[model samples]
Target chain A: MSHPTLQELRDQLGCLEETQRRFSRTIPIADAVDRWMPHGGLPVGCIHEVKGASVASALAFSSILSARIAGEQGNIVYIAPDRSLHPLGLLPYGVRLDRLLLVSARRSQDIAWATMEALRCSQVSAVMAILDSADLTSSRRLQLAAESSGATGFLLGPVTSAPIAAPITRWKVSSHVGKPGQRFDEPAWALDLLYCRGGRPGSWTIEWREQRLNTLFNQLATQTTREALAG
Target chain B: MARRFLSLFCPDVTDDRLTQLVEWCDRYSPLAAADGSDGIILDITGCIHLFGGEDKLFLDLQRRFHRMGIQSQGAIADTWGIAWALARYGEQSIVHGGNAASALALLPVEALRLPYEIVLELRRLGLSTISAVRKIPRSSLAARFGSTLLWRLDRIFQQAEEPLTPWRPAAPYRASRILAEPISTVSAVEYVLHDLLQEICKRLERNRLGSRHMDLACYRLDGTVDRCEIRTSKPTRSIPHLMRLFEGVLETLKSGFGFETFVLSVLDVEALHPTQLSLSQANPVEDESSFNALVDRFGMKLGFDQVNRIRVRESYLPEQAVEFRSAAVSPIAGAEWPAYRIRPVRLIHPPMSIKISILIPGGSPVRFFIGERQRRIVRLEGPERLTAEWWRDSNSRWGTRDYYRIEDDQGLRFWIFRDSSEHWFLHGHFA
Candidate 1:
């Protein structure tokens, strides 16, 4: 009957957000990985952070997530400070060059700002940001924007950076480049889900094939033998 | 049909004062052309009804000028030629449509807009007025004054006529407002633009029309113009969308010497019908109108050429498979993208030349160095031979290329190709 105060409106919005979370569609992972996710799979509207030991592994993980969301008919926005995510490099990971839009910002603050802007556009399915610095304030702003717009956001950062408490999920990926003199058929990745809201933390060694992660690459061909290589 | 044209002549007016005089005349009609350095002519054909009639309109205009402290002479005639002749030489007079020729005959030869030297020569020959020059035979007039004198006689006598080119083209839609005092602030410019847009959009709504291109003219107190233009791919009548396009444009402009008047003109328009909304689920941010606004905002900040849309091409060559096009265009319908097979996400243009050491003479590569990084190939997968038409003009660059997906010791994948000359080039990298 009367006009509601700002606090009461915020409380009402919280109730609406909780109800909306129940109806959100979950992205299904592989047979062994579903149980590890908070919603049995990744949530569509939440912020998911991925930290990698090296640039290669972190980029690979980001590409995998982008491909999954943008697969057949959606747009993916990548804002990077380092100008990575080469359209050529993502080809093997099943990401199309035409579907991805890349933005190269000179500063880390710009990358964070661009990520928030891209997320606010409902047409974009996912936003992958590579930033060296993101304080709690900017991260919270990005999170709020992503939630209201219903677009997923991923932060790809180094593993050694100090941890921030804004993202809902934190993941760390490490690359295993076989041995000094040998190379394997597939690149193996060690994915450690460091934290997830209302979910148990887990780790898995994943081998990217076709589109999703499946095998662990346990000596698929036993590194080329010297005599076999000679023949 | 008989139409009325008014010509105003302000003596000794030049530069800024002259332009300001012309700006003040825009109130009577939009088709007001500055006849010469000190004159303005208006096509008051259908506009006299607004201020009653020609007598009332001219009197009202004269009263306004008297109040503004600007002195000027005025005359009205059916043709611009006669009106121009009468306003300068004769007293304020209205020449009837059928009697314009006789009325203009007694005026001085300068009324024909002739060169001063030509008028002086005519006066020296005892022909002072236009009527005196008209008495001479046509051939002698041409022979003596080099044909221009004959042309001027014809114009004054209503024999041949010329059209007037207004300083600003008469647009189909235009709205303007004048302020009591000049404003030098940017916010004042926007406030005027917002009100003008509201007025123009109302008339567009009445006629079921939408404007695609518009221009904003700011008439400063110094009589100079600061103009900005906006264009949209689709015809739109929405005021907010148009205002959004002008935000960046307005920011870049300097208000410089406050403007006393603002005019918004619609340069191009098209018939637009109301759009029907779908009942099903829709994302608020990704609607059709918002998408256009987003593109317009991008064009505002960066540039229109920088925003691009991707389109699929049928060419089998990886480099030719997709093309980037201007964002204003719509993608070709039913043009399916070539299914992603083994294509790399990032392609190196012109194929970066590299040095490779293969394990065997005709076998896979063993080691390769691209740039400063050297990598040993641990696994190799191709020789996918692709050959082009030998008769093709561009095929002279390379006859054939064998593409291979090569992996190195660092778990990095590359799309490297070997040309007919047996040289390896890195074309793309795989994640």
Candidate 2:
């Protein structure tokens, strides 16, 4: 008898279809970046981290990501360290201020508890928590909670702090400079995928346009970027 | 049958002390009020059976007062007038129904709570006792004295009603539990609270009412009481939801020694219509309720103010553009935020002052040191001049602010402004 391949065994066990169904409910990040992820987008039911960005850049990126994952009518719970979120700035990122629940918790433990609570709630589609730092145990707990409820979690560290061991994907974001004479019509960021569970690392220069974060591939912008690889 | 009222008299207490004493007496009945500087009246009509009977209830009151170093007299009768009179003068403590006339027959006319001059005049007319006053015809008494005498007689005989203003408005929805063994542990308290919550929730459901605010009072073995309160964003009587709200609060309760009695009172209530679930399992109604429950949970853990929703305000100033409202409150349909304006994600309130070196007096900065690092502006936007709203506040001292959105060589953007005095301040950062 011939040995079955991994895909054939997975098909025979009926697990491949279930896995596809689970990963298929991805939160589409951007055009070029989604093609690089194994699941074609940021997978739901898991925690993702955004690091190496300034306070403003991290907030803008996470808010845009949260709005994309939440969709219309889905509630987004944001746990922040203070009452500093300007709702006006979020409008440009397609965030529905009406569907946003802001939880201001000062303590690290309180922030973790609130994030877990929001993740476990089926009513919430996305939970974005801005923390000073997060450890492995808390990150794992948050991941398990999101898995149980199928809600996407974004752990945003305003500054580039130490990385943790648990998030399925870790992203490093920095403000990307425009061409010397090119008009800076919109904000742009260089998103670096430093780690992925089942995919290779990649980089992209993305910008906000038409109420969504889209990949920027203009010759002038791509000059600063390294070679784009297909996964 | 007429309702019964209880009257207690403290000969030595003053007005302030009597007010406090009336509040303590609320445990006996819902309607407890301070009758005068020396007395308290309680409407214990159907509440007697709770303490076994009127005699037993009276004895309990006496025991409590004696323990508190007070010499008190108490009486129960068909009306507050009779109860008040009998508590002060009648030999019997409790008068049977329809026997108010016979009960006050031997008491002095002063027992009718008449004015001092009327009592003295009644004594002068040889009509000192209530029975002696009753001997005179009603017309004759009305002719002799004014209507005050007749009104007082009618009140004593249960012919007129007098309303008593209670010290605290008793909650219509309340449940209490008296533990056989005082509980000191948090788990035990939670168990008792769960039981009480079920009872109250049933009542709320039956009446189609939901409570927005609830107060839990734990009567400790000592004289003091420990209380904790929980409030929801919307009216709710869900036992599990309410129990979750109490989980964090129960731990903070000081069960010094132990708590013997627990009372949960619904402080605020609103009509909550029954919802009809759709045939399809996934509906927006369920999601809305669960979202509200999540907000309530966070509000209970943190303060309600800590859980907020941002609302846009109609103001020109950046700082006055938005306000944070507690999530527990229903959002008022406010003005929709206009298309995305050039605003920073994080606005540094009361813009921090920055040291700048400008080549031209009214021009943009050549270099500014944010902390110790010097930043050279690579790209500069504008000198968008915004004048102060002098019409809004005439006392305003500041004039115009020349704002600029500038990016440093590292591509870091800053929203800075130059005031009338040429001082530059960093207001916000573009994301």
Candidate 3:
């Protein structure tokens, strides 16, 4: 029997390549409710920044994003520079801390560098960079790295600083203080959104209701007015 | 002294479950080598003593193989080639070691190592038995069968040596314990480990050697065994150090029922000569031993996958500078440093697209509207152009990005870029 022709070999090679690509579908997130707006899940090839004051909210957001990605069997690298957050905080958020690679950085600069590196690995589904400070230049480099690695980046930092250009979505988070007239058990939140790209930065007052985050804009008016008077 | 050798063959083996079988055979003899495709060859030289002699060792080997869920045929002979042949063609357990000629008397002519066609010809000539083949004229046999068959036959009869190359070098010390009654308790298991540890330590002390790594195998009554392996920073023979290394392992040893026997083997041993050390050299500020112990404990408790070290790489590209490695393994040290440049403390995932109100051509935005609030741009700098990697994606939908650094009225600097297709997007900001 004669050997197979190069043309026939090429056809077989093409079939194999197509089969490989068919197997490359994105995995589903675990918490189905906490899906990303654009891609049903966080877009695989973009950087997402979560800006907040307290480490708790920032980590909560990280845990939520991590849980969704991990539920799909995707891996994440979480780089923290300032303080170590208790893994127990993530348990309530439905995150398996074991699935997360936690790296502690002594310097803010190191944290940024580490985050960029984590984003470079195509295997990593998402990267959460917890920074005490992030300037414009570092954010741009991180965004570029995220695009190259095909991983979603989440930047967590203070909201006091002017908006950095890095994150696709910028969330402004404040503490949800308990109501004075209401019972101590009342859940509270200070959450806002500056949808700079989509236009109109809407502010929302939210509280945890029955294990779910609920916006209570009406009740927050009183609190906002009181704070305004104090200012 | 009968020089007995056992060749155990287990055909129809699958890859998923071969490690346990290999480890099981390791307990019997350290000289076990994988043979043919699936068989394991054990040089039972001097190893039968622990089983109370040769015959008892053979019986025990059979029973253990059966208990471990493996079907095997074994043959013992003065020569490895004869044992191998008999195991495949003859009976379940073949014992032949009294004399070479008598041992080959009943075996088929094919056992003489002749090719299939030659063996068939010999059989047609009424030379079915090895004795009949031997009876043939030696010069005629050599001329017809060639030197290959004659040499193989001589090797099988122990006239020539057949060397066996083992998969791994034979470990210097091996200690095994078989509980009279299946021990289920953790304390009872620890009690047995002490004896094995002492034996291994004694062997090491006698050899004037130290082991950097060791493997502990707990052979359960159910035929399956749990393995705990440890590596040390320095070559050590101390029983206490070995015990300490196994502390976390011992805590998590779920008997699954109970283990009746245990085996401990020392690997990668090296000569460790004691030397006089100065006070500073002996007592360093950071003790690697304690640090390693702590890392090992945390790794074991939290699972080794959870521990990782952050590594930095030298790259002009900001995102290419750092990575993470498993904490157990050290990262490569001393890389050339990249040129120093300002990098963000934080980078957002999927860069947020911003709507710039200004119509500036190449320089920077004079003012940009972010959300409802409009911020006037003050100082404008940079039009650093970065092209997309087109080689990665041939379709090349995304074009080049012209990046700019602009400061707003509030002195808030931002990194904004315009894409190749001329669409503008706000990429990042400097605090």
Candidate 4:
């Protein structure tokens, strides 16, 4: 048999190559997303930890990410220590209640276990393992599970969490309300990527408007990225 | 061709131990039984060769029972009736093939396992042994005993095979470990658990079957038994994965007063097809098999009911739009959720009562109060009107709600609706 043509090969590899790119690269944060973190966006197929000053901010950040990553099918398995998540609160984040698989495990071990378990299912596109404390070994396992399953994983913890070099990307989300002229619009948030393994990290002011997330970038990319890095 | 049947008379074992003894005999054959009338019956027809024939096998059984502090009378004969008659009455005895009728003739009428009144009547009639009963006229015996006597004689004589309604095979897979000394330590318990699990898994692998539910019972020295059951979402034969799932559950078991024996049984099993591994599995499978282990782990760690998944319903109403079910059950297939203009991620059940002010008659909400926090609605959208099906529920009483999507100053969005009675309720929030 003759060797397959390059055109035929390209056609066969189009879907696989696109999925690989989609899962490995950064995603769009708000318009200001690029400036805060050197990494382009959240890394897919690995755990991206989002820590907030408190539980509320951390939870809000998780909701934003969960809704953003959910897309259309399957569930965002949310493993929390408590049933404090109000289904009504997730609507603004673009997460539908029907799309969420709520796993309320009380123990830290259970949370870690559940997070890893959720990552094993490829149908589960995203998982939020929100906890007060986390173990290093379990977190590493969670990372591997996500990578093997090719699903995005988020670890939401309090900002009090000491920086451990486990997550593919680390972020701190700041809650922002509608101001002055945008009083009629929905709430906004500011996300600052602390570090990314192989990409630029920057801070961005993002708003949820109409039906989609709009990035608010006001100036040139290089200048703001440099300024973000200096800070 | 004659068959060898081993009938064991467990005279010392009462209620629970009888069942245990029946399970203990499982190694000999799958068709072990204790009909609850008396002792365990085993049709070891062709299996005697496994332990070096009748003599060695019976010796081993006797030794094991003796070590366990149980007294048993066992007999092996060509027929089940002869075997049962000898084991229940005679000292542990074995009748060679073709000698079952002669052996059974010496046993008393009581050895037939007949009722007390029947034995009394038989003794009164001057017929007390199987040989004496055989001397009676067959029709007279049938007339007096209602055919049971003739039937019993026929069975005992090996002229006809006794109808054996064997009890259902005890849980196709079962394993038990008896400790020489009662063990209460966590490490000892874990070791025994692993050993028992391994034993059961081996049998499962041999049969190519997987079990979905397993029950572990710890029999304490105080004669108390504590049992814990774990269920899996998918039938599995994986010993390592099952061990992990049982780890959390085993910790909670009280080895109180020390456990002298442990029994692990597969309560439910199904044929688990072997999954062939492809040369290159480029993508992770998203089928029930992929999520089954995850669900099982969660259901075991957290309460099974605590983990619930949602399914979109085929309805237009908000409450009827979604359904919540226990995680143990598989999820509804397909992603074809009912289409809607916009569905809220979070819906407040029974809608929170809120104070609302409308700027114009039949207009959208301009202001609302949730608890003590006052939210000024900056922009409002819709009057998506829906009416309750009063015909479906007479209690609904023709209730109608006009829903509106509103944005507040906090950048939070709310889904509020006003009923026909003019009471506005906050039904959902845009998270």
Predictions' DockQ, in order:
0.20, 0.53, 0.04, 0.24
Ten-residue segment with the worst summed lDDT in candidate 2 chain B? B280-289
Write the residue-wise lDDT of candidate 3 on B1-431 in tens digits.
64566777788676434545655666677776776676767788788888897778888878877876788887777778878777766653656565556766778877665678888888888888987877777788889878876788778877888887765677667799977888878788778888898998788878778776788778876666787877654566766657766875787776877887788888778776543445866443223233344344334444444456444454333233444456655445624433223233234444566667666565456667767678786655566666656554632443666776565544344557777776676654332
Instruction: Report, for all candidates in order, the number of backbone clashes.
Output: 6, 0, 22, 26
Worst 10 residues of 3 chain A by lDDT: A29-38
RMSD of each: 8.6, 4.8, 21.4, 9.1
**Candidate 3 stretches greater than 4 Å from native:** A1-231, B1-4, B9-20, B33-40, B65-73, B86-98, B110-118, B137-148, B159-174, B194-213, B231-257, B266-289, B298-306, B336-340, B348-358, B365-431
Q: Write candidate 2's Cα lDDT for B339-372 as tens digits.
A: 6346677778668889898898766688898888
Better of 2 and 4 by DockQ: 2
Query: Candidate 1 chain B — worst ten consecutive residues by lDDT sum?
Result: B283-292
**What is the C-alpha lDDT profile of model 4 across B201-289, one tens digit per residue?**
78887777888899887876544567778898768877767777777787787877788778788988888766665657743232333
Query: How well is each residue in B1-431 modelled by candidate 1, as lDDT tens digits?
Result: 57788988877777677776676576678888787788888988888877688999889777766655677788999877778888888754787866776787788878878898898898899988877887898888888899888776666555776676776778899988878888877787788899999999999989989887898877655445677888775677888778877765887665676777777899999987766656676633324335455555544454455445555565556655555555555455325543334565456777899999876889888999988788998767777777765545675576688998777776666788898999889887554
Ranking by TM-score: 2, 1, 4, 3
Local distance difference test scores for all models:
0.70, 0.81, 0.62, 0.71
Candidate 2: regions farther than 4 A off: A1-22, A179-185, A217-231, B10-24, B34-39, B49-52, B63-71, B88-90, B96-162, B179-181, B221-224, B278-289, B383-400, B420-422
Quote the lDDT for B418 in model 1. 90
Candidate 3 TM-score to native:
0.54
